[model samples]
Target: MKVKFFFRKKEPQFNSIEELFDAVSRKLSVIISVESITMPYGKISFKNIFKNIKYTRANSGKLNHITGHINYVTLGLKGKTILTIHDVGSTLNGNKIKFFLMKVFWYWIPALSVKKITVISEFSKKELVSIIPFAKDKIKVVYNPVKEELKYQPKEFNASCPKILLIGTKSNKNLENTIESLKEISCELHIIGKLAKEQLLLLEKLEINYFNQFFISYEEIIDAYQNCDLLCFASTYEGFGMPIIEAQAIGRPVITSNMGAMKEVAGESACLVDPNSISSIKEGVEKLIDDAEYRTNIIHLGLKNVERFKIDKITNDYLNIYKEVIEAK
Candidate 1:
């Protein structure tokens, strides 16, 4: 069967969704012919919408499987198309205008046009179903696959000043609270994304030892995980906490939020903390630092947890979904 995976125009920065699906497509291509369709660079306007519709319609007839972003849902290929919904974050943010637009473009329209929807986590599936109740039966949960390079590599914990890895710098990543929590703690903060000016000022004011970088490659990300003593990913919201699993695959214990998909993805292998509470974040970190045996246990459990996110298993899941969708047609 021929599969066409649609993606938005590639950005210079790292994009988790594109990187993940691209890896899956490469593996799936061994058994089936798979092609990727990327949109032309343009502002989101009527012209772009028309171009997408024409592009989608032009290729709809030749492909056995079609899958892409939920916002790109078009009318012509209902049974053959699958829309991937990362999260219903717009609705959850309490922005009425954004919610209205999301309902029309991301949910209701996609619900009418696509045969099925794939979500990264059960939390995301539930959130999407709550907004578009009719889609409950159509949404399937498929966990994100870890990259092949991120495997268990034993490294001694940095005893002088433990290096704590933080993946993103967005507000939802709860970086402010994390910084506050680490004010009195001794650790080298290795942040992966561009830091806001305010965040930099706060870091300076708090006197937190830190390093920051952005637009890095996959190899550098693996290096970050391999070098860190622990991963701190206490985000307030997430579609799926990919970094938690990535850190686990690299044999690092994780500290993540207790709510939303972070908790769901971390399972029992991570130390859960309240993203809104500085004290909670501090305590969690302290526990990991002070207790060597507990830290060692979680590391072992994390290694085991990463087994479920193997590329082969996730690729086969997508292939099965494609086969089922095609056979049904």
Candidate 2:
């Protein structure tokens, strides 16, 4: 049977979902097509929303897959469809009116329209269920597969003056706290996202040695993972912590939060830290830096842990769901 993967016109830097499904679709034996909907000037106006919805409806295939971030289009879709929700943060973080509207259009309506819903982690499934409890029975948990490009690259551990990689700068990513933790620590911080004015000032005030880059290519991202001594991903919240597995897959040790999906995803292979406490995060990093044997042990365990996120297994997981949804009543 043919399947159509519906996607939004994503920015160059934000193509993880597209890249993920691109890999998944290639491994599937069935015929596949891709459809990307665009909005005028890339802004979400009502006119653009309706136009995109109409476009999506007209192009609906035998089996439809609504990728994350553009769930409202599910309202206009006919036939069997599956919706993948990476997180419910967008709906939960805003003011009351915005939250109400997002709940209606983004979660409630689209959820009712789809035959099956796939969430990236158990934490995400619980979050979605809490918002729309009736939809719980149909929600399935699927972990994000580690990218195939991130091969296990063994590197000599840089014990002296180690280069620590931090992936994001968002508030929930806990970048500010991480920076605070690194104060007086002997390591170079390589951050992957654009910094705000306050963050830059904080770094300067802390007298930390750091390098920052934004909108980098996937190759650069892989290089970042491969080159770093350890990944510091102490996020306050996440649907699924992708970097934890990615670092593990690359044979690098990881330090991440001990709560939410970050803890769930790390699964004993990472150095777990309390995201709220700078001292805890610092101590985690410091242990990895000072103890050679412990760091090596974490890296080896991480390599084994990444097997759970293998692409073939994850691809088969999606294929099974596709078959079930297509064959359902």
Candidate 3:
């Protein structure tokens, strides 16, 4: 019954997949290996450090160096080893040699040793196959789970500012297009997480108001989603878009880029827009804010959309995968 759970250790906040793992770790016979590098917080940020991307460089080089997995394998005589591969971005689109080398090197090392691999989205599963096709049969698309309370409350809206919530890191997320889109859309753009100084300067030029994204408790997030008109995700690419699902769970209409797994996660529930097109984003925002029929419809659809991605369902999938691996061994 012993099993090992492995994840990137230095992520400042526990990732959603890891949170689910922690919630049931004690009940399930599992050990975890966390990558001790602070890559999540220090390197990938919304903060606009235009030059001297030191943290990103360090992250590129050291993102997947989970130093102790060999030890986990050596010690686990009777346990199944389950690896969660959140995304394959570093390997596929880091768009640099150092990043490519590190990600490519570390990506397959775990699959070779672990008994099973849990991917967050099929988008990531496809990429993992592209990296090392041998692991395709072993990789399972276990969607990331959300807390029950985030969107469990009744509907609430703030007509004051008409907020369009865009949450993501500044560098990779298409903040530039979001800012451009804001010029046409009158609503206040609420961005979550830090942005670089250059991004601040640009937003200032666009005459768009932005608040530094603060960390909110689960209740607060639910409240925010309940209040907003649309949960706008302008991310260029994601392995799996968690915020979109979280927003949908809270019964808010989502206006996210049709890129990556967002469309798959949102299905027909969200209004898909082009992340690169400011005009398209502007149009999507306007539809949500001005058209009541559209907003209410998507909200209902979003609630239904989130049902497919329930945490418990994903967890059960993982449990089955673990059982299969253990039985095969």
Candidate 4:
């Protein structure tokens, strides 16, 4: 039986999901669905990149029924389907009324009707059960696995002025608070991903100097990790913090929130802060900036903590879930 992966690209171009699929497939026949946001790329490229197994393309957005239909077709009609739910925080993170109403339409309806559920973090699994308890037994926790080979050499720390890398699109990243933190410090701040209109407006109002970086490759991200003194995650919420692990793997200390699965992944390796408070984020960075010995300690803990998440281990977790679905069928 063939396995189909459903992925929607919110951004114009990126291969985060594709890279994850590459780590999971070997002897199995794989199918990929791209959620094309910009100009549509050829579906054949996905097949070629994925060893010409099978692939397709579709428009992005709330298409739960359409997504289920696509999986049914790709899985040979009678084949069991495994659906991966990335995050439910968008529903819960914002306005309560909007979040509540959206879940009735975008989340619990056609979305929970899957043969199997793969979640990236325990935090997400908890959120899923809270929102849609019917999907609990079918849910499986599989952390996003990043290959170790992608890691590049880290640059030597420059003690002059620290460089803080804030990664994420302008929307939902809480950049206004981040900019407030920047004002308190003298370090150069680098921002990544596309900006939402409100974020741009906030940046203009703050009058802070920031670089809008467009990344063409993972190497660009790696470069940011290498050069930066700290990776300021500063996100209000996430299912699993991918960059936290990536930065730890690359020997950079992370400043992330203590809420949700962020703390689960970061543990004691990262300096936890109240993401709502710009003062808290500023204080965390100052400790790292002023204390040389503290930086060494955190980096050492980070190196050790990163080893806990091997890509192969997580891949095996996915394999076990796949086997369960097949056996049940």
Identify the superior model by TM-score, candidate 3 or candidate 4: 3
Give one digit per residue, the lDDT tens place, for model 4 in 41-117.
Answer: 23434344232113332322222112211222222222355667667766455687878766764556534455666
Error of 3 at 66 (Å): 9.5
Worst 10 residues of 3 by lDDT: 62-71
- Ranking of all candidate structures by their TM-score, best first: 2, 1, 3, 4
Output the better candidate (1/4) by lDDT.
Answer: 1
TM-score of each: 0.94, 0.96, 0.79, 0.78
Candidate 3: misplaced stretches above 4 Å? 10-14, 23-79, 91-100, 156-160, 215-220
| Clashing residue pairs in candidate 2 (N, C-alpha, C atoms within 3 angstroms) | none
Model 1 lDDT on a 0 to 1 scale: 0.83
Clashing residue pairs in candidate 3 (N, C-alpha, C atoms within 3 angstroms): 9-35, 46-170, 46-195, 46-196, 47-195, 47-196, 48-195, 48-196, 193-213
State candidate 3's TM-score.
Answer: 0.79
Give residue 310's lDDT in candidate 3 (0 to 100).
71
Best by lDDT: 2
Q: Pull out the clashing pairs in model 4.
A: none
Give candidate 1 misplaced runs (Cα > 4 Å).
Answer: 61-70, 76-79, 90-94
Worst 10 residues of 4 by lDDT: 63-72
